[model samples]
Target chain A: MRLLIFLARRLGYSIFVLLGLSILVFLIARVMPGDPARMAMGPRAPEWVVERFRTEMHLDKPLYVQYYYWLRDALQGKFGLSIYTRRDVSQDIGEFFPATMELALFAGIIMGVFGIVLGVVSARYANSWIDNSVRVITYMGVVTPAYVFAILFLLLFGYVLNLLPTTGRLSPGVPAPPTRTGLVTLDSLLAGNFTAFFDALKHLIMPGIALALGGLSQEARITRASITENLQRDFIALERSQAIPERVIMSKYLLKLSLIPTVSILGLDFASLLGNAFLVEMIFNWPGMSRYGIHAMLTKDLNAIVAVIMIFGVIFITVNIIVDLVVSWLDPRIRLGAERAK
Target chain B: MAEALLEIRELHIGFEVYGGTLKVLNGVDLMVREGEKVGLVGETGCGKTTTAKSTLRILPMPPARISRGEILFRGADILKMGPKEIRRVQGQGISMIFQDPTAALNPVFTIGEQLMDAIRYSNSQEALGRREIRARAIQALKDVALPDPERILECYPIQLSGGMRQRVCIAMAIATEAELLIADEPTTSLDVTIQAQVLRLLGNLVQEKEASTILITHSLGIVREWTDRVYVMYAGGMVEAAKTREIFARPLHPYTQLLMRAVPKLTGEGIAEGIPGRIPDYLNPPPGCRFHPRCPYAMPICAQERPPFFPRGEDHQVACFLYKG
Candidate 1:
């Protein structure tokens, strides 16, 4: 019951945040020296046609009036027509959102698991050759962007080794399973198409890893530092004196306590994956929402731009709420204190 | 006196620092008898805590290395025990209560979780069921006089007051049924009003359980009131050891004498005088006696060689040239 209240409070705050984000994007898209209608119609189009397109788009109205109309339609799930695709902005997002979600979800898992495992290893063997090597690797991981890895993996795997599939969500001839959730891997699995699932998973590997590298490095570094710090804590001594095995102390006491800080940063890292996915998606031809959002931005597709921004805002806030809930679950002080605060 | 439960003979521990090793413990000797409360009293940095930690073999090794010594528990040398054997001795043979209750109990885990883990691991060979462990935990909490055993078990360490936390720590240390307990300044961080209560609780628990304890502290008053025998440490060495009453009545070592004088009297008579000069830098400690530079009764021979334990009376020994006879 207290959890429900906490979630409800978080959801309420999220709505306000998204609402502010919508307003900011709405005004910026207009004020940033571009007429969406003219850009959509392209150069050499007659002046009258541009004028008519502008009037039809409600672009000639006052900025507040335009925002109100856009918001009203948006609340009803109509974000007008995208200037780039000439499709409903909402429909475009719906079609593209699932692909990005799949990649982010896949990459997020990789980042979380491998990051922690590596971090534990690094911290356990601190000051040794293994720790030094991990330090060097993580340093390189942090400095290099996701797209660089994407290109490098493509060049090496796609061109030379040809070990993994480097393009799209699945092999072209395999045929997509029914678009139940639109995440090819999940949909294929749900449909019991093992072959399709395997193929989709294979396609996901390279892009997923490339996208995960940066966030994974950050996670490992944070986890290593936090665990190393926790090692010196007195509870560790108490655990040691109890004759608790080193394994139990490392996992139950040290890892659990150290994970709080690492988990705190995870929401931002995972959220940033969506923003960072634009280049990775484009390079891999993944048909993710970030690619669509990029096209929308290039053409100044006002409704599409605002819609994409709003969706990102929603995902970011939602991820934060989930992270907060996980943190509360890990720590009883936060769980009980949250109730007290209420 | 009962047979010795633990004995540390000529223990030398050093820390590898930037330039040189810090010789923290130099030929220190201590013995805790079966079912006897022994107070290891010394000021900070005097290696009392290091000695206690060494008994459990839990001191961080990279920085701290035992250069020389044998720590025997039940006639088995602890320093020679393998990892598996040492683990068996920990908690099952000897458990430790740390200085700060708040820091000793993990912040994230519940009182039940931490305590249950300790009990479960210590008795792993028994294959005890979950219900048995829970029952034992609740009983342990109850033994410590906590208000509600069930509720306290569910609460985190942060929820409890310092005294309560210390009580919980005592409960954890004693729950393993270890014969010997090493409490390193257990009440030092607690409130003054609560200190006596916790100490009394510890005393009662030790008596009730027929368990021996090595209480490490800087307070002579605690030692005088609580312990059977006292080993007064000075600059990483055992300056003197005798019956508690005898030590207060007649402090043999000059450092011990100064430590006794440093305690403020309740009558408001003379001011408490702390010993002059600081503990010598361990990196290059004084040659003959670590405490010689500060000894009021320092002699030429005191600086020439380290003094061995000289018997002054039955069950009393002091390391000072003045007692060379």
Candidate 2:
């Protein structure tokens, strides 16, 4: 019941956050040095055709008025039309967003699992060869960009070795599974097409790893530092004194305490992956929304730009809320809002 | 005489650090007879806590090394015990209550979870159910004179008061029904009024259980009030060991005598003189007696070699060159 109240309060605050985000993105898109109406009709189109496009889009109205229309249409699930695609902005996003979601989901799993495992291993064997190797790997992973990893992986796995699919969500000959979640791998399983599922999975491997590496390394570093510090805590010493099995101590006691910080930042890391996916999607030719978003920005597709940015904003906010819930579930102090002991 | 429930013979502990190996405990010896309350008294950094932790083998291994020692519990040598055997002894044969209650109890775990963890792990022989373990946990809390054991079980450690946390720690340590308990300055972090209450509760619990205790403290008054025999330590070495009454009546070691003089007397006039000079740096401690530099009665031989325990009277020993004569 208390958790419900807490969540409700958070949700209430999220509305304000989205509202603030919409206003900022709306103004920024309007102020960018381009006329969406002229761009939509092309440079050769008559001036009157561009005027009609401007009036239709409400681009001639005051900035706030334009935002009010955009918001009203947005709330009603209409995001106007993309100037570049010449289709409804919502439809373009609906078609493309799922591809990005699928990649992010796969990458998230990779990051969450490998990051924590490597971290625990590093901390357990701290100062040894295993720890040294993990430290070096994580350092490189953190410093290097996702695109750099993506390019290297593409070159190594695609051209040099011919071991994995380099482009698209599936092989050219393999038909896509019926769209259930728009994630080809999951959709393939849902459709019970084992061949397509394996093919989709194979294609997912390189890009998923590339997208996950930075966040995974970051998580590993955090988990390693947190666990190493927690190992020195008096409670851990007390736990040992009580003869708690080292395995039980590490898993139940140490892991739980160390995961608090790691889990809290996880949402942001996952959200940031969506931002990083733009280049990765382009490189892989994965047909994700981020690639579409990049094209929209280049051509000044104002409606599509606003819609994409808003969706990303919504995703970021929603992820944070989920992370907050998970953290509260893990820590009683946050769950109960109890006073900390001196 | 009762059989020694725990014995530390010529124990030496060191910490390998950035500068050098810190020789923390140098050839220290101690013994706790069955059902006896032994007090290991020393100022801060004097290896009293290290000694207690070593008995349980709880000290971090890489940093801390028991260079040479035999921690024997009942007839078996603890240092020689395998991981399985040492674990069996810890929390079952011997348990410890740390000085700071807050740091001792994990902040994240509920009181019930932590207490039950001790109860379950210590009694791994019996496959006790959750309900049975919980009942025992509630009983343990009640034994400590805590109000609402049920509610407290559900509460995080941060929810309890300093005294209450210490009581809970004591309850957790004793809940295992271990034959021996090591309380390392258990009341130091508590309030003065709460300190007495906690100490009294601890005393009562230890007495009721018929469990032996090794109470490590810097407060001479605590030793004078509670222990049967007291050991005084300076710079990682034992300086004096005697019955509590004998040590207060006739302290043989110059360090022990000066330590007693340093304690404020309730009836005596004016301020008591504190022992001058801090404990020596362990990285390069003084040769011979670590206390010779601080001892007023320092002799040429006192700085030449470390003194061994010399008998002063029946069951009384003082480590000093002066005691040799």
In model 1 chain B, where is the ten-residue run with the lowest total lDDT? B120-129
lDDT of 1 by residue, B27-62 (tens): 999998999999999889989888988998888998
Q: Pick the DockQ winner.
A: 1
Q: Residue A254 lDDT in model 2?
A: 88
Clashes of each: 0, 0
lDDT of 1 at A3: 80
Computed on alpha carbons, the lDDT of every model, listed in order, comes to 0.91, 0.91
Residue A155 accuracy (lDDT) in model 2: 96
Error of 1 at A211 (Å): 1.0
TM-score of 2: 0.97
Candidate 1's docking class is medium
Q: Pairs clashing in candidate 1?
A: none
TM-score of chain B of 2: 0.98
Q: TM-score of each model's B chain? A: 0.98, 0.98
